[model samples]
Target chain A: MDYVLLIEQLLNGFQLGIILFLMAAGLTLVFGIMDLVNLAHGSLFMIGAFVGGTLTLVTDSLVLGAVLMVPAMFAIGVLVETIALRTLYRRSHLDQVLATFGLILFFNEATRLIWGPEGLAVPLPDFLEGTVALGAGITYPLYRVVIIVIGLLVALGLYLLVARTRFGMLVRAGASNREMAGALGVNIPVLFSLVFGIGAVLAGLAGLIITPITQAAIGMGEDVLILAFVVIVIGGIGSVRGAFVAALLTGIIDTMGRSFLDVVLLLFLPPNAAESAGPALSSMLIYILMAGILFFRPQGLFPPRGATAAP
Target chain B: MKSQLTPAHAVSALLIALCAAVPYLASALDEPFYVIVFARIMIWAIAAISLNLIMGFGGMISFGHAVYLGIGGYAVGILAFHDITSAWIQLPAAIGLCALVALVFGVICLRTRGIYFIMITLALAQMVFFLSVSAERYGSDDGLNILWRSDFGSGIVDLEDGAVMYYTIFAVLMGCLFLQWRMVVSRFGMVLRASQSNETRVQAVGIPTYRYRLAAFVIAGVMCGLAGFLQANLERFVSPDMMNWHRSGELILMTVLGGTATLFGPLVGAVVFLLLSEMLSTITIHWHLLFGPFLILVVLFARGGVMGLLGSRTTRD
Candidate 1:
């Protein structure tokens, strides 16, 4: 019944929504442009968190670490694409899924071997730490507010790039029809590599930014990766606009459900029943939403115009 | 129609014989642990075979197929926790619940194909996983331990006996292989296989492929649930981890490793995968570093899996 708590929860939801968008954006783009289901996208996210966090700590500056992390992840993404994923593009989706899955196991264990089994804690730099007040006694973490702004800026920048640029047109064309795009003289391989690089950068960005709040940890990517998968599934795979909307929807619903589903359920169900069902139901909220959406719109909320009707 | 036997057939026979004789072999070798190890493999093999039914033959790649295992195991575990010891009730409930859930999931998932199908199944199964993880009454993430196995009358069957348990699993494994063999060759199986290659063409021939697919989905679910039931009995415990997405991926890997769409591929794949894991873990704690790339190599070069190597691509398929 407290309004301030509700406002704070909403802000928390917004922050989560932004993070989910960052992860989902890369996944949707890679899926749309290259027709690859990279399960190790999560591994890239994990690597970003580990590498970026380490760099920030070592350099004693967050900006320097993030700035350096982007290209490194981009290179890694491109390297993986050419070495493992490129061959899989022509193969069945099953093959693509399994290969990326292998990549996931490899990355997780490699991180464990290097970082050891213990998770890394990335403390917030002094300047970025504090509470930001938004009038009427409502306060939110300054870092989270920063995440919301940066994520929104990225979303806007992405929208403009896709809408206004010639490269954007190529991306669209490739997504819609790779063969025709290649026939018209687009460097499909180069374009695919570039898109893959971009995806890795986005995943890394999401990973690094969230680390200060969540701390860089091993196997952290799989849970969030599954969330991103749900977002894209609900948003329609390969659609950035869809990813944006669905990510926010998923993030908000999930945070709010986890925070207050028990309270809400208590109004209807008896005490013990509501108490037990609340947390479980809350965790299941987005999936239930996803299932409902699939039941209604099998293609998702924003399926690409021609997302390979073949199969 | 009769067909000539090939080396794949010999391999298949050998595998069944090997599984059947695991107890004697283990005792002869004086490695009692091998009985437990191979029992776990057979249990996983049953689950993988069920996954292959839809994924390989039907071309419906359900990334969340392992959820049925969790559901089945939980059914047994929860009932046993509450003092329900009868196998009759627990077994039927597991099968019926898994079948019903699969039917519901099939209605929604079958609506999509390819990657969409894959993601949706993964997400829905995650839903059930979370549900179990949150069930505080059932020990939640810690899972429940069963002191007693299912009772099938005093003298009719005793699952608690190791040899009896081992033989029971062997019977079930053979039953699954026989059932899968028969199902994939029947008119229904032919229709299902044709649909996998080309659904539009199958429909044009006046067959309702949707119903056939739904039926197959339910059957696969029931089969996997049976595996879960046996697993709970074998391990004497059931945890939410049984249904994790990682386990689902492994099931897919096993099917592909043995050779998708082949009759004995699931069993072959399960044997190799578990054995490899067992062997690798002993050599080093970081077995995944090796195993992961090995999976990649298999997908890249060994596309037909072990059965494919044995010349098992029958013309009938």
Candidate 2:
């Protein structure tokens, strides 16, 4: 129970929470606005990581690579939406799921084809490199601190945009009641596409940031995307505020549980059994949390104000 | 109720006949590969049929149905690990365990409808997958190998023979199809379908839809577990891969490819999907690159799947 280790793990959890929020934000928005379950959202995340990593290698600058990859990822997202997902908007949720699933396969294999099976790693810049010393023998990576700051800034910016802007109002309206929003002369299709694009950009941002920490692998998106799914579902689909809160909660709980569940379990069971069971139980923590949340609050922690019902 | 044979029923009969005859035909041709392939197909067909029962007729899309396969596979593998390789013990253990898992998970999942249900099921499956992966003693990600198949009795049923194994699997598949057919026409299944089409209406009529949906989910789970048991025996191995989300997606794809709400659609879907991939992979490693778009086209154009192409009315009652 060293303080430094605890702090490091806490920071790790916070960093994970931020990354999850980035992924979950777009998912919640697209789901909230378009009412489409895009299983391939993870593909977009993977594309961002790969594209960002590739651009970084080509440009030899992390900032520039991120800059270039954002729009590229945005364009990819819009293309997928326009080509594959647009036709599915009017179809049932099952159809949307199936179609997006197809997109997932296409993207995963396409990545493997183009990038090869080996994962790419993004190098951190000099300034972003190195560790910062906190009190009590604590040291934190500058990259992770930056991620937390960037995530918070994005959260604030998103909040202001959604709360203070007219377009945001329309997004809110559409999410609440698409028919009513359509009746009010909102260009529903364009708005939906824009929301989807914004979501793609957000997901890409998360992916780009994490490339330095994690290898930009072909199938990386799905692992995080599942957590993102759990985040949104627990946060309540279509609610960004809920997503943000739930994402952080999940990230912290999962990380802490993973790191310390064995220690906690040792108190109850034989040392060998606890050692073996801890990891398994810790891995299941968030899902259990999600199930518990759903069992209690099926609509999620934060259902949009007027819409107690899901779209 | 009609005595006249429809295209759907005729297709089902043809499928069953072909499945039953494949082992013998392959034996005649001395192609053990076909026997192996068909055995794998029958395994998947059973799982797909179970998925179709819930997804098509019950209108519950469980994205993690393959978890039952993992459960069943692991049940056999774990039992064999501890030296309990009896078919009677292992088979029922797998089914019972999967059913129990399904019961607990299904109860919670049924609380949510639509996309939430799908996500929850996926999450639950991932939970099982991760737990299995962490179980280092059981081979975890590497999976466990079963040295011997489930022994039914001394010389009563020898699974070591490929022909016997193939026929056993085929018989189980046919028996499942028959049971599924009977279940669909049964009063319980009628109520399940009714609830699927209109939950509110069914509830207004005083039917406990949740119980029926849970029952369907459990039934599907048990059937898939049976598939898993056969799969582990067929491969003589069990791994977390058997329960991966991708496998579950493939099961969904198979059911959809064949046609949902049709009894034999799963069989058709599994055969086409497995055979196509098997054939394609030999030509190139990037078969998924092509297979991916194929799935999209099927969803986009061939909405009802292969059986729908054969003029079966896949629509719900």
Candidate 3:
């Protein structure tokens, strides 16, 4: 009922949406272009968080850590693509799922081995520590506002790269028809690796930005990754625009549902019954939304034009 | 489908016999630990076999198959919480609930194909998982403990005894395998396999492949629910962890590790995967680091899994 609280939750949802977009963008692109299901994409996000977390700890500078995290994730992405995933693009989806599932295990355990099981945190720099006041006595964290700006900037940058550039044209072509793009002398393998690298970098950026808020921990990528999957699935798997819109939609729905479902349920049920059922129903909100979306539009709201649902 | 015994059939029979004999053999050797291990293996085998029905034979790669196992486990746990200990009631409830869940999921999911199908199933399973996690009446994330095993009502079977529980699982597993064998050779099975191999071609021939696939999914879900019932009886506990996405991945691994599309591949894969995990976990905490790469290698080099290594007929036919 309070407008201030409503605005605050909306901002919370927007911030979460921006973070999910970072993760989902890479996932959609890799899945769209390479036709591979990389379960370890979450592992890449975890690795970035760890790298970013560790770099910030040692150097005591957030900007340098941010600068290093992208390249580190990009390098690891290229390495994984060249070593394991390249051989799997032509394999069955089952094979891709299993192999990448294995990578998730390997990455999680490797992180535990290297960093120990204890979660590592990155402190907020001095300048970005304060909160900003909006109208109606509403206040929001400056760091979260920065995340929104950065996420939008990245989204715009990706849109320009994908829509305006020659390479973006090739990516579009590849997503629509891989064999045709390859036949057109696109150097398909390198293009695949580059796309993969970009995807990894994007995931890494999400991890780096959020580590200060969420803490860098082993297996953190997985929870976000599942949400990212929901975003892309509801958005249309191969569409970046879909991922962006779906991410924000999911984030808002999830945030608002969690915070307000109990109050809303109180209107329909007795107080005790509403109290007990609200949390469970709230947790299911996004999935129910996803199911409804899939039921109506099986290919998602914004399926990439000319690309078949499966590929 | 040939009724005559072949080399693969002989090998499968030998494996089943070996499984049935494990408790007896371990008793003679005075190692009760092996009984527990084999019991766990049999439970996992049942779940894996059900997964194979959908994945290998039906060509519907459901990534959330383990949710049935969780649903089954939770059915018994919830019933026991409210003082219903009879196997007749608890088991039926588990299977029925699993069937209903599968029907709902299959209806929505079968509308999509390939990766979309996989993601939708995963999302739906996660939905149930979150629900379980929020259910404060149950133990939620900590899981619930059943005070007593399913009461068979003065029958010769007493699950309180480890051997009885083990044999009960063994009998159910064998029954499932038999059912699977029968289904795979039946007219319906042929339609399911054909649909998996080529959906358009089958549809062009006038078969409603979606219905067959959905039926296969439901059957597999119910079978997995049975496994969940036995698992709760074995451990006396049920948690959302049982149906976590990782567990679903493990089911897929077991099917692939054994060699998909083969009759006993899931059984074989479950044995190898569980045994390897048990052995590796003792060495260090980083066993998954080793196991992960090994899984990748298996996918890369050992494409057909353990049964494929034996080079027998890959499919049930």
Candidate 4:
């Protein structure tokens, strides 16, 4: 109930929101541009965390682990797109869902087989280890602050890449009108592979950055996949700016709800009932937010232009 | 209409008859496990059928259809706990509750199409899951155990008897299959299929396709509820895990793997999925390691599923 605790929780929420944005950006881009529903995006995140964790353990350097993960994830992304997903682009959404869902099953089991079911811990670097002091005796994890900073930088970079760059223009054109982009000799297939690779790298980057905070494990991507879906839905599909805002909003709302919901409920209900209801209600908070938003704007907060009714 | 059935129809009917007779034959031969496995497969078949109704017929890809199973199971569990084990009360309540929930959720979700629709349904189901986990009165995350199965009158029909329970499930499965077959050929089903093929055309033709789709969603939910009730009785337990998103994925897998849009597809899918799981688990602890790649192979090569593959070959010949 104190101001300092509230502020700390708010910061925690913001950090979570940033991470969700990172995950959602790639998903929205894939959906908007490719018109493909890739359920395996979460697997990309899982792979990133697993690979990054292993590399960090070997190299004993967070920076090097992250740097290596980008290219590694990019390669995997391109390979998957070329080998499996290319055929699915011409198929129905149901087929795409099944195929990608298969990829998820494959990736999860593969990771478990390789890394074991027990989660791997990614230790924070010495400089990012301790808590930084906030005003009024409050403290927060330095690593989390760095994540927020990095996430924002990525968000800004994405905005510039999509809105200002030539590649971004082609991507936008492809998203808005795929056949037209192709007709204009945009090399649609190669562009699609590039987009897929970028998305994979972003997902991997998010996984690597969040690994220090959360122990890397198989099936870790499942929950985050759902969260990223929520983020994209709330932000408006195919909009990075929207994903950033929605991710931050969801993260803060979800974190604050989890941290303070019990305290808030105590005012209306008895202590035991409040304790029991709090966790359940907190878990539902973001979903409720999503439902509310969709109720008002079925297309989401910032829907991409030329997006037709999805099949 | 002609009284004679087509050769294909006759063959399917014969197949169903053979399957029904297998349980009795197995029990008579002192192999009750086969009957038990068949019964389990039938229960999941019912669940898969429900998923196909939405995903295949209505063009709605719901990633959380397992929530209905959970709802149905919890209905039976909660009722049994309160000393109301009569089918007269429990069965209606289960279907009704699932339908009500589906109606409310579908009203909001059916507005959106494609990926957004998929994600929203998933998120809502997850919310339901979290709620189930939080409710301490219902055993929370640990789940609840049923003390007794749904009771019927003595002598005539006793669900406590395994043979009787197996027969009951088989009868229900047959009834569901028949109903689905009849539904798909009906006028309403035509509209539903039309929507699935081309919604814009259906809308342009002055059909308010959303309403039909919503109705289909409710019907599917109710059927899944029936499956859930049987599952609770069969296992003598109910838990949140029954309604997990993973279970939903499995339901979708069953539908696709068995040749969606076909009348017997869900049943075929369920039987294959369960049998495969049972066989693989017996062989190795890390069965999923093998099963995962198998799924990928199925998707990559077998786009038509088992039945579709069979149907195509037969047509060619």
Candidate 5:
């Protein structure tokens, strides 16, 4: 119930939201442009974390690791798309779900085989290690602040890429009508691979940045992947702007719910009962939020152009 | 009428007889493990059959069918925790709770389709999973254990006995298979299958297909719940992991693996899935590594599933 502690928790929530945006943005784009349900998206995030974590360990430099891993992940993304995912574009969603679910099992086991079952942590650079004073003797981790900044920059870059570039226009056109775009000579297959690769890079970047705070572990991407799905559903699938706003909202709501829900519940019930029930209820808050949103706005907050209406 | 039994029907009759004789054979061999494995397979086969009700005929494609299993399992576990060891009360409660959850979730999820339907169902089940994980009163994430199986007294039946449990499951499976066959051939099943084949055309034909699909979803949910109830008693334990997304995937896999759109497809798929797991685990600890690629191969090559492969020459045909 400390006021400062509550504010700190809110900031933590914002940071988490920013990270979720990074993951969700790429997912929304892939789904929007290519009309592909990529369950292997989470695998890309895990791969990024693993690749970044390994590079950081070898180089002993976070900056170098970050720089090198981005392109490395993009290449991996392109390779996966060309080899495995490209063929799936013309298939049904059931096939996509089954194949991607298989990929999850594959990636999880592969990670375990390579990295062992234990989680590995990346050392925060010395310059970014200290806490920043936030007045009244309260301090927050500077590294987290950096993550937020980087996430914001990426979000901005994404907006420009989607809104300004010629490729962005083609993406928008493809999302609206794939056949029409293909008829217009958009090189649809290559375009899908490019969009997928970009999505992979974005997910990988989010994984890399978050690695310093959280451990690099097998199956780390699943939780985040689900959250990203929730964000897209609430934001309106295929809408990047919707993803941004929804991700931030989900992050703040989820973090705040977890941190203060128990204290808030104690007002209505006995302390012991509240303590036990609060966490359980709080964990479900975002899903409830998602349901509520879907109930009111079945197509989401920002329905993408040319997107088919939901049943 | 006697010659009406075709070769396929004769084979099916022979298979049923062999299945009926399994317990006696196992008992004669004194291999309780084989009986137990068969019993386990029957239990899951029932669950998979329930999943197929929605996925195949209803075309709902719910990814959270296992939630009913967890609900059914937890119903038994919770009742046992409160020292209510009666099957009469536990079974109804399990089915009722699962029906209630499905009612609510179906109301919301049936409003969407395709990817949204898949994601929403997954999220709702995850909500249930997180709730179970955080429930300190119900042993939280570790799950709750049953102290004793439901008993019906000396004159009738004792479920505590393994062979009795096995026969009970077999009877339930047979009953469910019969119900599924009846339901699929009924007028309602025609509507559901029509919707799956062509929603626009079904609508053009002046049928309100959404209601039919929703009804099918509820029925499937309730059936899955029954399976969950049986599974809880069979395992004598319940955990959040029972309702996890991975289990949902496995349920779908069972349906698809055995050949979707077929009456006993899920049963066959579940048996194959469990047998594969048992065999693979014995060979290597990282069995999922093999299972994952196998699923991909099934999707890529065996689109019609095992039953489809055996019954049909091509997926589209």
Candidate 6:
């Protein structure tokens, strides 16, 4: 095993973790607070990338486009909540799932219609186009490092907003008991919209950030959204901290397993057998972990305190 | 639960008769494609009916129900590829394997309720999907094409003959509906439905609900596998796409759109859904744009489904 390769993959895992955390955070909050399962959350990610990437292309300033992406997604979030999802909060989980799944179909087709089938190119600005060297002769892309920093900063900001502010307390209260919070004069509907907007922003930001690295093709978020679901399920739904922890764990496990499972499998099986099984097993590693976790603790590793599992 | 004839049962009978007439209707209209299209609908209808057993009646919503369809397809596809074309072997293998997988998955998934059950089932199915996609020896993402249809080893049931294949599917659909009707009305199904409404109460009444649910889940899986088996025979093709998350979503849509927990609802829903898709796709490739919003509207307001709109019994939550 080369030490350099190991360190590089670790960084890769970390970077992936940061991205998953961004997506999972919003998902956890929405699921926690609104008690809605928004499968179209991934559609927001796709829309964010498309809308943000387009803005950048038109304005020719990545910073401005990125800044504008926030309010754009937030407004869309609020609009969707008020229109499509508000009635769904009290509906059955199956209804929420079906509605959101419909949203996914609608959004994907809408994107194809508006943006055409081709992915929009969000070219890296000149300054972000280089690699930075760390000590021990290991170097990594500057863009990925920036993503890590931005992700951590946002994570910290979210923590402070959720933990330190009065609104954060209300949000937590809403998660724990919505009826109590409503009786206590919290504007529950407005709060729901606000939290939904925040989730949209986070999901959009995650999408916008990664579009430069991966093509913002139609339905790009569908695959990643499943991974986010895995994060929340393993982390326990309605728990932000759990989402964060689960996201990173999922990211690292997925990345490392994909890169190194074959080598590890070689020790236990013949070369040809190991080669075929490696990819399949690696892709399944996290799900196996999730199944194991669920078998032992169906509520997940860090279920929210005092919140009903179904809600 | 009633023995009297109702509009629901009449509609179901009418639809099945329509399905029986599809081949003749197609040939009379001189359009061979309609036979295949209605056959496709019947296959999905079977899958939808299986899903309804667990979801509509049992209250165990499996978002990954289509995986069995894929597994069934692959069973036949892989067997036919290896020159094991006998329906005797392929049919049993598909049903047995699907039942076993459903049993294991049901054990783990039943530990959770509501959304967790939904997500876990979907995730597990996705696990199988990724495995299939990575199986380079089995044609992976491109899917595998079988050279021979399942050999029933008799002159009477040649699958390569389109009429025979279509009728086989029709018989299977009729069999599934009969089985579903029988199971849901039986003592076991009553226990299952009772548990769905209130598990604790049912348990207090001295009925163990877990085994009933597990049995229903496995039966549903086997039914869906039969759908997959027929589909593979119809197309002579199998791919991971058959079992992906989207297919599962569509199955759920069919069950719900036709009205869940009702006799004939799956058939009605499948007919409407596939017909709509076929009609919409003809107008433009972006039919999902319309179809998607329509689904949302259905979920939002038309929760009763086509059968419900047509005077089926009210569906329970």
Against the reference, the lDDT scores of all candidates come to 0.92, 0.90, 0.92, 0.86, 0.84, 0.91
DockQ of each: 0.83, 0.77, 0.84, 0.63, 0.75, 0.81
Candidate 3: which stretches are off by over 4 Å?
B3-10
Question: What would the per-residue lDDT of candidate 1 be over residues B23-54, giving only the tens digit for each residue?
Answer: 99999999999999989999999999899899
TM-score of candidate 4 versus the correct structure, residues matched by position: 0.94
Candidate 1 residue-wise lDDT, A1-311, digit = tens: 38999888988888899999989998998888888888999999999999888888898889999999988999999999898888998888899889999999999999999988987888888989999999998888999999999999999988887778998889989888889999999999999999888888889999999999888888899999999999999898888999999999999999999999999999999999899889999999999899999889887898888768336
Q: Rank the candidates by DockQ, best first.
A: 3, 1, 6, 2, 5, 4
Segments in model 4 whose C-alpha atoms lie over 4 Å from true places: A269-273, A309-311, B1-11, B153-155, B312-317
At residue B257, give the lDDT of candidate 5.
Answer: 88
Interface RMSD of 6: 1.2
- Give the per-residue Cα lDDT of candidate 3 at A209: 95
Q: Rank by lDDT, highest first.
A: 3, 1, 6, 2, 4, 5
* Model 6: CA > 4 A from native: B3-5, B314-317
Tens digits of per-residue lDDT, candidate 3, A94-207, equal 999999999999999999999999978899999889998876688899999999999999999999999999999999999988899999889999999999999999998899
Error of 5 at A110 (Å): 1.1
Error in Å for residue B202 of model 6: 1.0
- Model 6, B27-89: lDDT tens digits are 999999999999999999999999999998899999999999999999999888888999999
Best by DockQ: 3
Q: Give interface RMSD, every candidate, in order.
A: 1.1, 1.3, 1.1, 1.8, 1.4, 1.2
Give the range where candidate 5 chain A is weakest over 10 consecutive residues by summed lDDT. A302-311
> Model 4, B1-317: lDDT tens per residue?
12234443454566577668877788689886887788888999999988887887777899889999999999999999898999778888898999999998898899888888888888888888888888778898899899999876577678898878888888889888888877777878888888888889999999999889999999999999999999999999999999999899899889888867777778878878999999999998778777876776777788657766655221111
- lDDT per residue (tens digit) for residues B182-212 in model 2: 8888988888889888889999989888889
lDDT by residue (A1-311, candidate 6, tens digit) is 38778888888888888888889899988888888889999999899999999988888987788999999999999999898888898899899999999999999999999999997889888888899997787888999999989988999999999999999999999998889999999999999999999999999999989888885889899888999989999999988889888988999999999999999999999999999999999999999999999999899999998897762
Q: How many clashing residue pairs are found in candidate 4?
A: 0
Compute the lDDT of residue A169 as modeled in candidate 3.
96
Per-residue accuracy of model 4 over A1-311 as CA lDDT, tens digit each: 48888898899899888888888999999988898888899999999999988989999999999988889999999999998799888777777877788788778878888998897899988988898886678888888889989998999899999999999999999988899999999999999999999999999988888888888988888888899999999998888778888999999999999999999999999999899889989999999999999989988999888867454
lDDT of model 3, residue A136 = 68
